[model samples]
Target: MNPKISDFGLARTFGGNQIESNTNRVVGTYGYMAPEYAGNGIFSIKSDVYSFGVLVLEIVSGEKNRGFVHEEHSNNLIGHAWELQNEGRSMELVAKCLGESINVSQVLRSIHVGLLCVQRHPEDRPTMPSVIMMLGGEGPLPSPKEPGFYVGNSTQGFYDGSYGISSNSEPSITKLNGT
Candidate 1:
């Protein structure tokens, strides 16, 4: 797969064991952002992992992570997937178009791995290498913890009243001057 990543306007580079990078201004797409990065201006390798998990879910479900809505449950795609997984019904999250053409076991395993990457706490998320192993079925997969940004039933404002509207648009790119 020829994957191309763009929009590095808010990106930064870090060296050594300095995974955590503090910032006075945070800017990025909402749905794909890790909770720690969004809630506080803390960026790290784990944060990118969280975004990867969201992307995985979106690909599997053929849905957007941020603006997803269901009549039965008011959850974003991640939250909905987590709920289905907890109930041992994760297969339900698979896109209908993929019906019967895909391997069930592989899809389920992928869902598991995706959930692992999006755990609420960064420490709970597996590293990129570990994620690869899990995807390859090289080892036992651990149970996933709760996912980040799992908004449920509450219309609570997120991040200074900049929640709903922006989440529904194209990937947000915000530039803030660091003090």
Candidate 2:
């Protein structure tokens, strides 16, 4: 029973020994929802991790990646974090409230870890164990691969029906083994 989490709004009631139940009502903060949970009604521990990751990035950077905008760059907070991290200047990502009390390296490390947690691919995202281990400095973390749906590719388009090429508009090509 974590005292901090015991009073969360999303918390629900359950039988003392029951495990794996369903819910008729789906309710939570929008930006905090996992894709599957929001799309469907599924909920799990990993959903909580995704929300926590969002919270962490927001806490450290004082910015919401979901709607972050910069006058100089088109990239979101995840992209900004990646760029700053790649350039070895991650301290720029930290919130001003912490001031000099925050450790630059640790803050950067947390940003990296948070980015990894919120990766678009659920399988690519680390399990809670990995996330906990990362925060606790338990073992060497794996290098995060590029985030999915990376911005600025014209060929790729929306998550909805936005970029499909009509077959009627193009001739099909048949390649022969010898020709």
Candidate 3:
């Protein structure tokens, strides 16, 4: 099902010309959260765009962003995609199941757009309208920079060992402070 913004319980609404907000508490699904929101509790339009990019990548690859592992490389899905894109092998990211039914050009474009959304800095990410335009072939897309949290391996810090949960397990609650 397509998810609505209100379906996300942690989402906050703003009024007037406000575009961003800070919170002492940070909470969300770990893999989908933007680095600024997850690391510093700074939420903005770009943060949601980051999540959208992850979703797009997941849909294209049939893989989860969190707990993704590669045998030949230690990179996560984003890092793997980046590596492949740089090496001129972005088509490798498409799920095998898609097979001949998939349009190669569209898949490559989608991958490019996903990487654009997950760029390290918020300003580097395209806004929703810009993203739509890019997807529609409106203009040349800028090359993507490194993605945030592009670590070589999964770290224990993402989990709460006290709960006897696996590192990939979603916690009941997560709190973060913004400065």
Q: Pick the candidate with the highest lDDT.
A: 1
Q: Rank the candidates by TM-score, best first.
A: 1, 3, 2
lDDT of 2 by residue, 12-111 (tens): 3443233223444455654455444444445555555666666777889998766677777666566566667667787888988888887766777788
Q: In candidate 1, which residue pairs get closer than 3 Å at backbone N, Cα or C atoms, i.e. clash?
A: none
Q: What are the per-residue Cα lDDT tens digits for candidate 3 across 64-178?
A: 8877778897666877888888899988888898989987888899999999998878899987777878888946779998786665433423223121223232333473544
lDDT (CA) for every model shown? 0.74, 0.57, 0.72
* TM of each candidate vs. truth: 0.79, 0.61, 0.78
Question: In model 3, how large is the Cα lDDT of residue 20?
Answer: 75
Worst 10 residues of 3 by lDDT: 158-167
Candidate topping TM-score: 1
Model 1 C-alpha lDDT versus the unseen true structure: 0.74
* Prediction 2 TM-score vs. true: 0.61
* lDDT, model 3, position 102: 87
In model 3, which regions exceed 4 Å deviation?
Answer: 1-12, 152-179
Pick out the ten consecutive residues of candidate 1 with the lowest summed lDDT.
Answer: 1-10
